[model samples]
Target: MAEVKASMAGNVWKLMVSEGDSVDASQDVVILESMKMEIPIAAEVSGTVKELKVKEEDFVNEGDVIAVVE
Candidate 1:
């Protein structure tokens, strides 16, 4: 399993994948809004999405787990 983590503190602007979705390595899974910019969080490994640790508009700090893939 692989855990996708946020790269910076921000509000989750969007989720690009849902549970059970298949994704490739480096695929953007979440978008974070901070400092008037949108940052995309990508999957580190290719796999099926197992869980989403955050929802849209949720605040997360740097390195916070955003999703799980297996």
Candidate 2:
């Protein structure tokens, strides 16, 4: 399994996939809004998305797991 974690504290601005979607490494999976920048949360490994831990407009912190892939 692989975890998709937030890089910094931010609001979840977008979610690009749902459970069961296949993804590739470095794919833009989520967009986090912080410090006036749209920081993208990317997949670390290629696999099917298994879970999403945050929703749009949800606040998240650095290192928080935003999704799980397997």
**lDDT digits (tens) for residues 1-70 of candidate 1:** 9999999999999999999999999999999999999999999999999999999999999999999999
Task: Kindly report which residue pairs in candidate 1 clash with one another.
Answer: none
Model 2, span 1-54: residue lDDT tens: 999999999999999999899999999899999989999889999999999999
The TM-score of predicted model 2 comes to: 0.97
Compared with the true structure, the alpha-carbon lDDT of candidate 1 equals: 0.98
Off by over 4 Å in 1: none
Native-to-model Cα distance after best TM-score fit, residue 35 in candidate 2, in Å: 1.8
What's the C-alpha lDDT at position 53 in model 1?
97
Scanning candidate 1 in windows of ten residues, the lowest lDDT window is 1-10
RMSD each, Å: 0.4, 0.6
